[model samples]
Target: MTDLTDRVKQAAAAAEADSPPPVTDLAVTDTALHWLQSRQSYFTDALPRHVDQAHFMSVALSIMPALVKCTHESVHTAFLACARFGLEPDGRQAAVIPYGDKATFQPMYQGYIELMYRHPRVDSVHFGWVRERDQWDYTPTEPSPRDFFHKPRVDLTEDERGPVILAYAFAWIDGKRSQVIILNRAQAEQIRNKYSGAYKKAERNAKRDSAWHTDFDAMWAKSAIRRLVKVVPTSHELAELLKADDDADDTTTAPPVIRGTVIRNDDQADNADNRTTWPAAAEPGSGATADTDGGEQA
Candidate 1:
């Protein structure tokens, strides 16, 4: 027998020795493998890709009591029950990606973050440096302990569906997450467009979670930040005033800005997806103040 088989046998024997006669021991076999595979496919394929990972598994497992109660239900009926599961407070707070070509794997990350903590969106992930010593200090004495200090080992969920994942991490896992989502390009694009600059999801093979790689980080650091950049700290009047005060004597270049578009014609700008070009300076009161570049007319 293989070492794994031997290990299973020894483990089973130990369990039997420690437990009361009434308790059952798990047996490993081909039949067990087949059952596991079938259960896994049902949970995974039943849901729409739009569903985040947490809700997907939760919905799938909720049917177990039904499966247990109605053992006679056809396997097809049992499988369909997962898709039909309804969540109250519809669309509560999904970290939805815009439907687009680029966001194919966004939901996986959304699910991953949701699985770890109930954050509202990917933009809200709090990432910062942690000292190596601090990390070591938190290590537990045993592996896979229930304590948070142990840090979770990414693994298959109890429902047999795949573990929640992030596109960042999926790179290290050989694009499995992308492969899963790419099955529906429409769904993937929807996510990609919304989170266009949200993640550094590269076309290259994914090798890890988080954009630790130079190219990976570069994408988010530049593009994502442009998206993340909130409205310029103050309105144009305040911004211009602050600029004048700070550079009372200096004549250096201006601060970088993500957005500075200001359209005076509310009606035209509101209806148009187009942006009006601004000159360094427009004729005074032309309702064109592009010249006062404290950022933009906006």
Candidate 2:
């Protein structure tokens, strides 16, 4: 009986040693690196050749410090979404924002322009904010053709340009301008109240960290382009991205579940039935300016 018990103890110890370490045992960066490495095939198939493994890893690590405070599953989902969009999360083209303990992928206005330009038919895309002091003109019918014009007051500083009254986005297809979508301040506020859960939460908590609070004009530009895409031709990828943003807009919806290699606590036991349905792609509606140096030209 004593010999048999000893053998059982030895077997159990060996089995425990063979099992993978719990997620908490590793540094957040190490765990993220491991997760990204495991998805090597996925990235290779999804990204262009110029985005090599080293470059991909560097981008992932660049933002891990900020992501460290977020839930592991949320981090994984954010990275997955970032990979799906093929945008770099350098806070310009795209960003991974942390809302409470949840991390959400946000595609910047520049990112939208980047994706729009990818379509073969798309020639140029432009978004601008109209200020009270700016010269603006729009004619639905004149000279046998519709025309729109906006010239920001260059003499005044950005703040001195006065409050923004409108936001507009238009695209060129086959070198011809498409229908322009313009949103007035009231209209833009309605859209924000309707589709921006993050903004609402920030308002409630009085948090100034959200881009919606910090970069209102940029978010307004994004809203204008989002509406413009409805009438314009869009790529399947862009459509999917828009849908993701819509999903994220609904505050009641849960964040997407990480698909594979579930990470759990050291004390937790493996359970085959722990899987949950993956939610729709989630996006946060906060990003930088619509135009920047080196951005795609109209």
Top candidate (TM-score): 2
- List TM-scores for all candidates, in order: 0.18, 0.68
Task: Check candidate 2 and list the clashing pairs.
Answer: none
Q: Show the lowest summed lDDT stretch of 10 residues, model 1.
A: 96-105
Model 2, 63-176: lDDT tens per residue?
Answer: 766555566456666666666677777766677887766778777778788788888999888888889999989987753125788889999998999988988888888877
Off by over 4 Å in 1: 1-28, 39-41, 50-121, 127-129, 132-298
Model 1, 146-188: lDDT tens per residue?
Answer: 2113123235332343222222111112211111111122333
**lDDT (Cα atoms) of all candidates against the true structure:** 0.27, 0.65
TM-score of 1: 0.18
Specify the highest-lDDT model's number: 2
Q: Quote the lDDT for 30 in model 1.
A: 30
